[model samples]
Target: MTPRPLPTSPAPHRVVALLRPPQAPFPLACATEVFGDHGPAIPARYAFELCTEHPGPVRTGAGYDMVVTTGLEALERADTVLVPGWHQPPGTEAPPAVVAAIRAAHRGGARVVGLCSGAFLLAAAGLLDGRRAATHWARAAELATRFPQVRVDPAVLYVDHGDVATSAGSAAGVDLCLHLVSSDQGAAYAMRVARQLVMPPHREGCQLQYAELPTSGPVADSLAPLLEWLSGRLDQPVSVAEMAVRSQVSARTLTRRFSEQLGISPGRWLLDRRIAATRALLEETDLSVETIAGRVGLSSAVNLRRRFHEALRTTPAAYRRAFRAERAG
Candidate 1:
């Protein structure tokens, strides 16, 4: 089918999630949350639908079944095609017809998305041959090993390269959907959706899934005070020794507590908190890098950049530019 050029005029964008048998329910639900119903508070600007290769009831890994009459043909007319996580039985491949349909839709101008392991299907279709993509960190190695041509980033939540986008596991799918909403509509609309869902307005797609410092336990009795202190002193130099002193514990004891409860060291937790603060500053303020670094306890812009890149794979400037552009556009 010949696809029409994407309309430059702003309109209600259509997002179709192409599901397969035994699909990941979370990604599908995430797609629905961000695009499904806008209710009365938010203006209706998105048209979301669930489409499958063949019309009828599709089984989900979640042990339920859903009826979806829309088929692959709907994809040809879509502005965007979302492939949520796919369930490929061990040593099995996605149906070839599905792969062909995905390629045809993309070739016809619809933006293609692969959330989580759905990326495997997109990769198999040759859509991700030379582009950077991400999957669940657990599946990254397998995807890389199988599709040597695709650059797999196990660390990022998602990667957007204009026409094609790939996301990491589970909740990252939310981030990708929100991103598409932000890109197609604007940050204001995306934020409205996020607010409706009670999630962060935006998160750096590169944010780590785990803290460097592990929690010892729900020793809110002790940790609560520490967190409060840490939050208030984001600008100060915090050390394990200082934390231990304030907590009335020895450095060794505190380290043990962090390991048993948090899974990361106290120092790492502090750094992560600082990084989170830095990200907030980057998103919410126009502060200079030097100023942001000091405010986030990073001491220097150079240090902040290095840490930010290591954690997110994008520079602070690029991150801000992308988010700001999303906000404005």
Candidate 2:
């Protein structure tokens, strides 16, 4: 039988997820739930499917089997190709055919994605070489050791390279998928999907997988009240001097405490919090950049843009457009 031609129009993007033996079901389900067709109230934005290398029953790590009919040929028609999680035994390389198929799909203009340990597959395919990528923090060191060419970032939730993307651990896959939806359709649609999934509309890809909370001890305990105060005053101009005064400690002592407990200097910690606040405001509200800057204590829009771009590698305007719902005429 003759195969139908792939859609040329960009709407309803085609997503082909690659499945391999011993698949981890959670990440696979994350991709499916985000890209799968919902009922008519929310129009279908993605045509999602699963494809295996050999086209048959694929074993999952969750002790179940999924029958896959499509093969690599499905990738030929995909706008995006996702690898949820590769076969376990973290060091094993993906089959040569699977690697080649992924490379071919990328070459043919599909945006390739890897979730969790699936990043090993993209690295093996040469897609992540010389590029920043993320995987489960536990396997990040091994990915770096095995590949050597990929710049592995174990801290961030995900890394998107326009043509290729990778996410850390199981749930981070949902963040990456929602990002894809926002990129392809718009933030409005992505938020709809997120609402259905009962998830935050967007999580900046750069958010730390695990926040650096202050370690417990006398010094950390003493500074807990000051930290709570700082959290509430993010919209005001704050300084290490003020913090030290509030904590009744010398500047040097406060600096030492911040470094020992939070693994960051006081100023750096404040800046990180401001940036995080800016991102939340950008995603959830329609506030102007100037207002957001003031709200986050960055003070000026110009400085906010500079710091935001320096930190996230993208401008606040672009970030807002990517995650904010568009207004109707």
State every prediction's TM-score relative to the real structure: 0.63, 0.62
**Ten contiguous residues with the weakest lDDT in model 2:** 210-219
For each candidate in the order shown, give its overall lDDT on alpha carbons: 0.83, 0.85
- What lDDT tens digits, residue by residue, belong to model 1 across residues 192-292? 78988988788777664432222233565767788778889989998899999999999999888877776678988888788778777888999999999
In angstroms, give how far residue 308 of model 2 lies from its true place.
20
Q: Which window of ten consecutive residues has the lowest lDDT sum in model 1?
A: 208-217
The TM-score of predicted model 1 comes to 0.63
What would the TM-score be for candidate 2 when compared with the true structure?
0.62
